[model samples]
Target chain A: MVISRILQKTGFYFLIILVLLFTLFPFVQMLSTSLKHQYDWGNPSLIPQKLNWSSYSELLGFQKKEVKVPESIHRLLNNPKLSAEKRQKILDRFTSTSDVFPFINYFINTLLIAGTAAAISLLFAVFGAYSFSRVRYRGRSGIQRGVLLTYMFGGVLLMVPLYQISVQVGLANTSTGSILTLVVIYVVQTLPVSLYMLGNYFRSIPESLEEAAQIDGCSRFKTIFLIIVPLSLPMLVTVYIYAFMIAWNEYLFASVFLKNFNEFYTLPIGLKSLFVSKNAIWDRIMAASILTALPVVFVFMTFEKHLIGGLTEGGVKE
Target chain B: MVSHPGSLAQQEARFGWKTVAPSLLLIALLIVYPVAYNLYLSFFEVKLSGQNEFVGFNNYIDLLADRAFYDSLTVTVIYVVGSTLGTTLLGLGVASLMNHKFPLRGLVRGLVLLPYIAPLISEVFAWQFIFDPVNGIYNHMTVEVLGISDERVNLIGTPGNALLVVIIFDIWKNFPFAYLMILSRLQSINNDLYEAATLDGANRWQRFWNITLPELRFVVGAIVMLRFIWNINKFDEVFLLAPNVKTLPIYTYFTAFTGTIEQGLAAAIAVVQFLLLIGLIFLYIRRVLKW
Candidate 1:
């Protein structure tokens, strides 16, 4: 009996360790490679020979070490009669001013746009979900059903017509126009699920609380932001995280609308451009990859306490 | 402001409309109109010069006649079914494991979700490197660690091999979602059921087979169908990881966005995919979700 109990414990721990290893190995590999020097690229070991932090430093804009430029830029700069404006333009290639993987710029752009869109979606969904859940109205259930239906619509169906609509509205060429277009599109993509999640969570909050709030002189609108929204804080965070991620990681529509606007590139587009432009440097690529994912993971972990799985009972993945 | 019965009801209805108006307006413009516009565009040969000639059913004819369309359809079916089943099962397995007591169980749970939580761009790069022929850990594992083979394995280079790689990649990326849903329901299940089963002389496996599986059927069914719906529309997952694997989204992407710019045909393909998706969603909501 003792032997059987020991064997069962060993088996259980073995499974746990196996799962941990499988889940973490890729991340470990990526981190290891990001810290490796150029010579260590061929090494299969998880640890670098000497840990190199230059990629992270450079990517995060802390250090400005002069790296080797491509031969084409060197060749262009060698011309003696090159105009000063054009010469500085060519030299700006190495600086953050030029088009070379501006990680900071892209990071800021993604943060502002995705963050703003998610905030807007969350604020609206709070009200929409409140109405959908508590208020009695005609066609209310029909609209709820419709929200789920729209959520199910494949994005590919919208890409072409959406692009056309953006173009027609003069929202495709300029940076602000594209930014607005992406915000609207992101809101559309994330709103249904946000409403769905908050609605489910809101419905669970007892109506007696709202009745009490109303009896205390709060209007229905104020009652929501004041009482209801505060009550569902965890679910609200869950909704914001979901909405932010949808906009943050979105690539399909971003690719179409922002193709011509390089300065306004989101991370997904910027990262793809990086992959295309600099395919050779493993350290730089992996470094940007790590940095791009850091903010989301940080936000998630900081709010990990709210990961009450019950909050997302029927909610599927974003 | 206490009012008559009909007046208060009228005021509540108006408040509901006022609250949801922004969402409804945005939905109408972006989703509803785009859906209708896509259907309308399917009937025309959309050109760059703003002269869209009505092509009627010809675009659909061309799409049906094209061999690549059929090939991609087959691949999409396989990819969706394979990826969905893999995620659901793996999710159930992992959730079941973590449901039990263990050391650092909370940490392990968080770490497992890392795959799902990581950004696609970052994860895709890691995966691309992992499948890299020369220095990838995949090659290192199969060739050196496990001694499964001596030659370096190239999983994403060829079309047939690429499909399997993308499906596996998707499973790794998405299973946490199913795990999250199932584990919540699993925890809610009453322990009395299990206690009774044990007292009735049921073995652990038999108890799990009878009670746990039946309890999870609804959640699992909803998850599997939702995965089916989402996977069919997935683009960046496969595109960023292995651009060569032409699932339907990528297929439509190539058609509409690039390479010949046959917008009409692409629109038709999207229309068909949307129709199929509507059917699936209705079935999912009515049958699995029972909404």
Candidate 2:
């Protein structure tokens, strides 16, 4: 009986190890593909025989001439005192900068859009979640329902009208408009999950401590910032990281909304472009894909503890 | 913590809106406005670079008549159903395995979440390469190991297998989410009930069915409804993996933005997606809110 039990347990663990390989094998393959030299797509090996950084270097614009913008633009104000020739020279320098990968602009645009949207949405969601957790209100139940139900309004449904509105508002071909629009979408979509996690954490904190703070003549808001925020910092970071990851990885909205603006393509869009580009180097594309996913990967690994708490406690209720 | 109940109620009400005001305002402007506008657009004969005219239900009629629309509807249904079933069953299996007090269970559980956290584009692309006709690892393994020699089996290129492969890919990527939920819920179950069941000569299957199943019904119901709704409106997985298959969301995209640029028809399709999503959410609310 003991030997049979041990065999079964060993088999279970062996199966688990296989599952881990299943989960992580693709990433390993992608990394291997990325590290292969430019002309090695035909080799068809899991392990790269030779490592090359050329694809990555090309992506970061290492092969491009540097743009020397006038020191005036770097200054607080524009210097109109500069000659037209000097201004033209600066413009010329900017235009003359030639990137090798041809998608460096898309990279920066993605970062700006994802980074800004994540940052802003996190700021709003954290405060909103805190208030819902700590405060009492007549319509709190209704508001929470409303917030949760809003996610049912999938972005695909809004694509057409959003396009028209963007065109009308002169934001049709801009990255800022897409990012702001996405931030709004993500904030509402993610708010319910964030609130649920935070509310759980907040409830876990003893009310006696808050009462003590109240007795000390602290305002409710002040007490919250001073007490609860400090205690819940890990979860707060977890929520922010989750929100950021979602924003970064989002593609459907980014694909439809930012089609006309090549310069405004986010990492997801950039990766898709790699597939469809004229000079679609498979190795380089894989390299770019690796780069795009690195941020989210890092976030997940670093915050696994808080993420598990947030998720298992009902963040991913779906 | 405030003393006055009467004035404090009003103050709390004000604070509630104050805290939620920015998000509400943003939702109203972006979500509410666009939804309303889309509804309006669906009713009109709108076109790109042309004046809009009121054509009540014509767009809907045209879409309903279009053969591709029906195909897309069917595709969307199959995709959702297949993926949901796959994920749910796989999740159940994994959760049961984790329910046992095994060594290294914590590490294995954490590692299983890798699929859930990976970026969709990268992972989906990886799947694409795995199923690629010439050099895909899947084909190589099958042909070499399984002794099946079909000449260059294009899993994604053929229509029937294409959708099936997409469903497999979706399930592979998403089962971890459901597993996490079930495992957590399993951990919270009281062992006393199981102990009683065991004392009553209840075998493993009997205990699972009688006690475990009953205890997990609520979570399972909620997960089912939520997963159904989510998978139904899903765009990214299907759209990216099998763009040619024309799921509802992908079809809508092509109609409106990419291919034909049929703005009115696309708006109509979008409305259909919205109504379906809302109906699912309402169904989910009725099930979950009972608790």
Candidate 3:
């Protein structure tokens, strides 16, 4: 009996380790490859012979190499008429980041777009959820059902028609116009979940608190801001994180609307293009992948409990 | 009666509409309008110069006969089934394992969710590298380490193999969601039932089969259906990893954007997919998600 129990305990731990390895090995490979030199990959070892930070530095613009000056521009830099200061300015202007994948610029673009869309969706969801949960209204349940119905359809089914809308409105023609169109699409994609989450959260807040405030002459809008919003702050953060992750990871509509506008490519688009580009450097690509995933991972790990609670709460009741 | 502004209840109802109008308008314009518009566009021959020539049902007829469409449909069915079943079962296994008391349980629980929460692009590339023919560990393991095969297999380079790989990728990336849902449900199952089963002289497997499986049936069903809906219309997960996988969404994408630019045919495909999804959603909402 003692031997059987010991054997069972060992078997359980063995399975646990196997599960952990399967769950985490790809990440280990990514980090290992990113830190490896070119020749380092020829070996079978998981760790690099030497830890190289060059790819990280290059991608982050901290390498101090500035940019690769094109070979054709060599003559221009050496022209005697150019003063040292003038030549330096010309070099700075002519330095090309297109080949390097412009990680920082794409990072900023993704952060701004994802942040703006999440904030906007959260803001709209708060008001809409309050109305659904608190106020008496006509067609209220019907509208609620309609919104939920909207959540059922697939995004691909909406792509062609939404594409036509953007084109017809001429938003497909310009960079700024395309960015705006992408934002609108993201807002639509994220709003349903935000509404569902915030609406559920709003329903759970006790009516007595709001009623007491109303008796003290608080208006409906004022009570929402003062009582409900403050009370649901954790859930609001949860909703924002959910909405933000959707926009942040989206690639389909981003590809459709923003393909012509390379300058505005989000991280997913930029990263894919980098892989398909002529010089696909594994180290740099892996480094970029790690860099791209870092922020969201950090955010989620920090708010894991809150986010999971909010997600499972909605999920369980449904 | 509620439309009257004179009564306080009516006034309150009016305020509710006022507050909810922006969101309602947004959903109406974006989701509802586009769905109807897509159906309308399916009947036309859409041209590059923004001209539409109405050719009612011709796109659908052509789609019905398209060889690529048939191939894609087969691949999509396989992909969805493989992924949904894989994730659900893997999720059930992992969730059950984690339910047992273990050392560093909290940290292990958090780490298990990494695959689900990581950026899709990052994970896609990681899988690609893992299966890369020249340098990947897959070839190294099979050919050199195990000596099972003498050849370095280029799995992603072949469409059939690529579809399998894509299915595996979807399973790996998405199982945590299933895990999360199932784990939550598993935690809520009453322990007293299990204790009663144990006292009644039942073995672990027998007790689990009787109690745990029954408890998990509804949640597992919901997860499978939800995963089906997701994988059916999935775009980037398949596309980014293996562009040649040729799932329905990628097919629609290629038809609409690349090659011949058959926007009308793509719309036709979308309409069919939309109808299928509505059926699944109703079935899911009415049957599986009733809990």
Candidate 4:
């Protein structure tokens, strides 16, 4: 019995290690490949022979040396009275490099679009959630059910018509248009879960507290802002993280709508473009992939519990 | 007093509408309008220049007869079933192993979720590199280390093997989701039931079959159903990993945007896929969720 138990434990740990290796092997490969030189691409060794930072430097736009301004132009650079166009031209001359991985603009665009969309969706969802949970209005349950149905009817199915509509409405191939479209789709996509999660959370709060606030002559909006919002900060964060991740990782809509607009491409689309681009460079691609995944992985690590909770909550409930 | 109460109710109702209007409007515009328009477009021949001519049922007829559509449908079925079953069974096995007492269990559990939570593009690209014919580790291992084959195989470049790779990728990427769902439910199972089964002289396999399998029935059902709905419509991973592996969504996309730009035919394919999805979702909602 003792021998068998010991054998079982050893086998269990072996399985655990196997699972870990399977899960993490690709990630290790990505990191190692990102640090490999161009010639090291086909190296069979897991660890690169020599670490190289060229991929990172090139991707983050650090490889380019600052352009030297001529003495006559150096005087104009110091002039605050320089016209905006002239200033832009001077800065462009100083900074432009064809060797940089054309991702800085895309990265910033994704941050702006995803961040703004998450914030806006959360703002809207708060009101919608509060109404569904706290208010006793007609058509409340019907609307809630509608939102749930739409949640399951995801945006992928609507891609064709959506693309057509965007084109018809003159919102195609523009940053502002894509941003606004993403914001709307994400709001619709996320609002259902945000409402469901937040509504359940709000319902968990004692009703008497809101009643006491009302008895103290607080208005409805004031009661929500003062009494409810503070109590549901964690749920709000979960909703925001969920929405932000969806927007950040979204590929289908971004691919279709922003196909012609390189300036508005998100990280996923940008990474894909690199893959399909002629003369594909593996090290730089891996570097960009690592960079694209880092922010999300960091977010996941920090808010791991909330993220898991938000996902499994619907499943775990009775 | 009666007037005051009535006005207060009216104000509350108005506030509710005011609160929900923005979200509702956005949903209607983006989701509802597109769904309605997609249905309409399926019946018409549409051009890139916004031209539409009523072709009533021709797109659907042509799509049904199309060899590629049938090929993709078969691929979609095999992919979905393979992935759903692989992930669930693997998840169940892993979850059972995890239920045992172990050192560093928490860390292992957390780390296992990395594949699921990491950016899809990053993971897909990493897999692509790993399976690259010339430089990939897969080819290196199979050819040099294992000596399984003398010649390197292009896993993603070829169609049949590409689908296999895609399925494997889906399982690797998604089994974590199944693991999470099953593990959460596994932790909640009563220990006394297991002890009771043990006292009855039941072996581990028998105890698991009687106690654990039944206990995990609902969660397993939920996860499988959810995976079905998701995998059937999955576009990004397959599209990114191997565009040659033409699943329904990728096929629809290519038909609509590339080649001949048959927007009408693509809409029809989408409509059919949407109908199928509705059926699966209904099963998920009714059978799994019981709502």
Which candidate's DockQ is highest? 1
Across residues B56-130, which tens digit of lDDT does each residue of candidate 3 receive?
A: 899999999999899988898899889999999999999999999988999999998898888889988888888
Q: In model 4, how large is the Cα lDDT of residue B210?
A: 96
Candidate 2 local lDDT, residue B213: 84
Clashing residue pairs, backbone N/CA/C < 3 A, model 4? none
Off by over 4 Å in 1: A67-99, A308-311, A315-317, B1-5, B144-147, B280-291
lDDT at position A163, candidate 2: 78
Q: Write the per-residue lDDT of candidate 1 for residues B75-127, one digit (tens) a residue.
A: 99899989999999999998999899777888888888888878999899888
User: Model 2, residue A187: what's the lDDT?
Assistant: 62
DockQ of all predictions against the true structure, Cα-based: 0.73, 0.52, 0.67, 0.59
Model 1 clashing residue pairs (backbone): none
Q: What is the interface RMSD of candidate 2, in Å?
A: 2.2
The best-first sequence of candidates by TM-score reads 3, 1, 4, 2
In terms of lDDT, the poorest run of 10 residues in model 4 chain A is: A309-318
Predicted candidate 1 versus true structure: per-residue lDDT over A116-167, tens digit per residue: 9999988888888888999999999999998887756778989999987777
For each candidate, report what fraction of the true interface contacts it reproduces: 0.75, 0.59, 0.72, 0.70
- What lDDT is reached at residue B175 by model 2? 85
Ranking according to lDDT, highest score first: 3, 1, 4, 2
Worst window of 10 by summed lDDT in candidate 1 chain B: B1-10
